[model samples]
Target: GNLPIKKVLIANNGMAATKSILSMRQWAYMELGDENAIKFVAMATAEDLKANAEFVRLADTFVEVPAGKNLNNYANVDVITRVAQEQGVDAVWPGWGHASENPKLPNTLKEMGIKFIGPPGPVMSVLGDKIAANILAQTAGVSSIPWSGSYGGPDDGPLQAELNDEGTIPDDIFEKATCRSVEEAVEAAKNIGYDNGIMIKASEGGGGKGIRFVDNEEDLKNAYIQVQNEVIGSPIFLMQLCKNARHIEVQIVGDEHGNAVALNGRDCSTQRRFQKIFEEGPPVIVPPETFQKMERAAQRLTQSIGYVGAGTVEYLFNADTGNYFFLELNPRLQVEHPVTEGVTGTNLPSTQLQVAMGIPLYNIPTIRKLYGKEDIYGTDPIDFLVDEYVPIDCHVIAARITAENPDEG
Candidate 1:
């Protein structure tokens, strides 16, 4: 049931685009050979074309997209999808940015009969919403931090009506619904306890944007207002923050045939603000048993959701007490995925494309070798593939560099 993918559209720019194009070529050459190699189509803006970007030069062909708007050219779903159809692209690979996590892009591509090299639109929507993801994690038997609000409550229920009518939560419904008012947040915070502090989070927030911390009830109102204003109309929720924790994530890939495997993990603890600046693989700080538990939890969650393609399951690990809580699931290839790739020796971008082409996990070359079984019949592949500990080949670390304008600050 393999889908024929002769050409792919790289729907991103800069490093993401370059890496994706190279991975596609390398995978095609190494696996398929010269004549059957996949061709890549890269997009460029007028500015990019003027500068002769590396990805444009690397691709087999290029398409020019409109420039100078609020959203980047690659982020425009209509333009990207239209270009894909016109170019006869068999698949679209959104490499971790632009429209990578936007369900609209994939939904549009699906409607157009072009393959999306990521999870389906509905799956992306579920994982993109923090509340829904948390609920999914808990349902998959993954551990999560305690929080208030009825997870997955109806949008048009009494809670929504109350928020629409008065812009506040009734005291009676404070414990069972998301906080629409400062008073309700404060109440939820008190119930959840403020020992480690409370995090006011926007369910739709990402990249460290719509979050605020309050150590006491006195600062709760201002923090709540700040987050609400920052991400307007996003549902806000309260959770007990885990103090002195390390950010650890498991690299996982699932396929359409209900098979998944954990490709070890990375420790992304070092950060500036909430953004990770340094990342390393095989989080040695945590006990091996703890790491295995995390891998198992991640596999269970991935299988439970029927996730297809590469994704990261992040967790906050308290090394002091050996406890961890599910933070969130990033439903796309992460920027720091190379660290896991280094230790695990897997090309994730290529794997994503293969999964999109209806390739099962057991049929994937790297996964098949790692599973180390001649025949996978009569075994639950999820458990059979990941139950044995696969030692990381080596340790690797990555540091992100950024340049900021001093004058702007």
Candidate 2:
């Protein structure tokens, strides 16, 4: 496992998380330092024209990837990978949040004798898929919205029936179906009150754009339709409409040797328009017993699947019913990963670089003592949105800059 994969190209758009880019660049630049040997670049798609140019100017190297943003289909995979190979990029980093749609890109990179940074292709696929994410959590017996990674056809129709409009779902009901229609979605949303009123959502590339919490039919219709185009336009939609509850997430680092350990859990209950405005660590509602339970669950899944690099196991809570369910797995670096960094006082991305270099996570200890403590979830623990989208622009750390259009950059 000699993973000396330096020079990673972070393939994403300008509209991507500015904070995430900053954090990763901070580490990548430091890793390179004055060596100037290997370069970690942020490759911008056609859509991310302005930001990509600005980013390249701010950081070190940049690539104006002409790759299409409409899901890495036949042409995009080869296009971006070709850019990497042509540019002599050592590895490709798809940024934080989830895996790449071009599953072939990783293998293609490997075959071309280049390294694919972040999680391995298969591991990323499993964790990225909602249905597969649930299956990963099964060995841990972690509760989630009860989901399948993708939607099924006729066989799924009956399960879909259970969520009839205005109808109620019994607590004992297992086996849930993925819904797309506005009507079925509304019924599922209304059932949230009884089911603790929560839902889980995952999308292809738009990581923070898909989640929605609907207390009733109206909310469901509004949210479902709003996100439907993005959902249906793609090959698959990893969405779960369930109860609104506690936001529990555990971050981990694994290696090819199959060592996985929880970095601790963070509660991000406060969010707006799907963006986590505030986040804290140690999980308040999830004390020692639940924290350990969640941690062990995540570790087992990671080992069973031979997952490597950083990943997160998300969960939804029904505080009223006191029931928490496993949500979805984020297969890449997270936007809120910094809070976990702030809490642990550890450089997660640096540790990730080590893992990318074939380092095992055995040196990292489990958070058993952290569980025994009060499990402080972190600071700034609330979503700052009452109405109107604020974006991260308002934050001090965030700098606002105007950029020219696509070709202008």
Model 2 segments beyond 4 Å from truth?
13-37, 42-54, 58-60, 67-76, 97-102, 145-230, 233-244, 319-322, 363-409
Q: For candidate 2, which ten residues in a row score worst on lDDT?
A: 384-393
- Which candidate number has the best lDDT? 1
**What tens-digit string does per-residue lDDT give for candidate 1 at 245-328?**
999999999889887789889999999878889999989998998888998899888887778989999999999999999989
Q: What TM-score does candidate 1 get on C-alpha atoms?
A: 0.90
Error of 1 at 250 (Å): 0.5
lDDT by residue (45-121, candidate 2, tens digit) is: 55556434555544356666554534452236676687788878777766542235445667688788777666666
| Local distance difference test, each candidate | 0.81, 0.55
Report backbone clashes per prediction. 0, 16
TM per candidate comes to 0.90, 0.65
